[model samples]
Target: MELFAYYRSTSSYRVRIALALKGLDALVVPINLLSGEHRQPAYRAINPQGRVPALRTDEGSVLIQSPAIIEYLEECYPAVPLLSQSLVTRAHERAVAALVACDIHPLHNVSVLNQLRQLGQDEEQVAQWIGHWITQGLAAIEQLIGDSDYCFGSEPGLADVYLIPQLYAAERFNVSLAAYPRIARVAALAEQHPAFIKAHPANQPDTPT
Candidate 1:
């Protein structure tokens, strides 16, 4: 197995956490998103979408997109289940994950912000654009989580995988996590989990010194 990823890519970070939690051994190949390596022709052939977090499975097929790849992992390896067994509970977990992966993360993606700059938005405006969406999303997640230790249960599940990365991205933009105490609490606990610790951006091979 081989994972093409960027250390700071939130999407890639989600997969990294999942892999670690499952105790899977896969070669990690860094894709420098900052330097547009993901957009290069060679990488584009590997992932037509030109995004990081593409996984080459043992079967020789490649999977792109973080959510889909994670689902595949869950299906193929059920030992460390990330989704809940209860039907309603599983749905809610997916919803929470989508809340961050779909609704929030995209608005603040690098390409999206670059488009804002292309349209003449200055640095402050771009930052505000990113913050506004995150603030709204975090507010909703705060309500959804209430006082849960993890997003869905005592153990970190799919929601926690998605939430942790979004929180990391939020801190990068200097977004105030104070308003969402529940999220902050959950994030703090997750940051200490062995799997999460190994998957942290600071610990990645490509992370700059």
Candidate 2:
């Protein structure tokens, strides 16, 4: 298996954490998003969406989108389950993961922020836009989450995988995590977990010095 990823990408980070938790190993192929490598013809052929974290499976299948990739991993390798078998609990976990990946993330991804700039928004204004959405999303997540060690329970699961990466993005953009103590606490605990430690952006081969 091969994973094409950009180290700092929140979406890619989610898959990395999932893979580590399942004790799966894949060749890391770094796609430098900052250098526009994803826009090139070769990468576009691999992933028509031209996104990071495209997984080339041992079966010669290519998977795109972080959520879909994670889902595939979950189905194929269920030993270390990231989701509960209970329908309700699974739905709840999926919702929490979607809250970050879908609602909060898309609004401020590189493409969207670049679009905002093209439409006459300055850098600071674009940053404010990112910060606003992240704050709003985290506030909602705080309300939904209980006083558990991870997002849904004592063990790290799907929501924790999603949350940790978003927190990394939040900290990178200077989004005020001070308002969400529950989130802060969960992320701090996740950092200490071996899987998460291995999946961190700083530990990735593509991370810039």
Candidate 3:
């Protein structure tokens, strides 16, 4: 398997965590998003959406979107399940993942922030925009998650996989996690977990010095 990813992209980070948790090895194909590599025709051929985290499977099939690739990973690699077997618990886990994936992350995505800049929003305004959405989303997640070592349970599952990357993004944008103690605890736990450590943006092949 090959994973085309931008080291700093939260979406890519999520997928990397999932793969590592499953003990899967995939060649990391670095796509320099800052250098506009993702916008080139070569990457567009892999994912017309031109986004990072496209997975090319061993069978020679390419899967686009972090959600779809992750779902595929979950289905294909069931030994280390990222979700619970109970239907209700699975739904809850997915909900937490969606809060970050669908609700919070997109609003502050590079494309969205670029659009805001084009619309005359200054850097301060963009920073404020990132802070507001991340704080709101994380505050809700803090309430939703239980008092455990990881999000929703003692084991790192789907929610942890999603949450850790968002926390990284939060730190990157200077959004404080001090207000969310449960979230902070999860982050603290993840800091020591081998999978999380291996998947960290700082540890990625494309990470800048």
Q: Ten residues in a row with the worst lDDT in model 2?
A: 84-93
- Tell me the deviation in Å of residue 135 in model 1: 0.6
My TM-score estimates for the predictions, one after another, are 0.97, 0.97, 0.99
Give the least accurate 10-residue stretch of model 1, judged by summed lDDT.
Answer: 145-154
Report RMSD for candidate 3. 0.7
- Give one digit per residue, the lDDT tens place, for model 2 in 7-110: 99999999999999999999999999989999999999999988898999999999999999999999999999999777887888888999999999999898
Model 3 bad stretches (over 4 Å): none
Error of 1 at 171 (Å): 0.4
Judged by whole-model lDDT over C-alpha atoms, candidate 3 comes out at: 0.95
Each prediction's whole-model lDDT (CA): 0.92, 0.92, 0.95
Candidate 3, residues 64-126: lDDT per residue as tens digits? 889899999999999999998889989999999999999999999999999999999999999
Best-fitting candidate, scored by TM-score: 3
Q: At residue 90, what lDDT does model 2 achieve?
A: 83
List the candidate 2 regions with Cα displacement exceeding 4 Å.
none
User: After superposition on all CA atoms, what RMSD does each candidate show versus the true structure?
Assistant: 0.9, 0.9, 0.7
lDDT of predicted model 2: 0.92
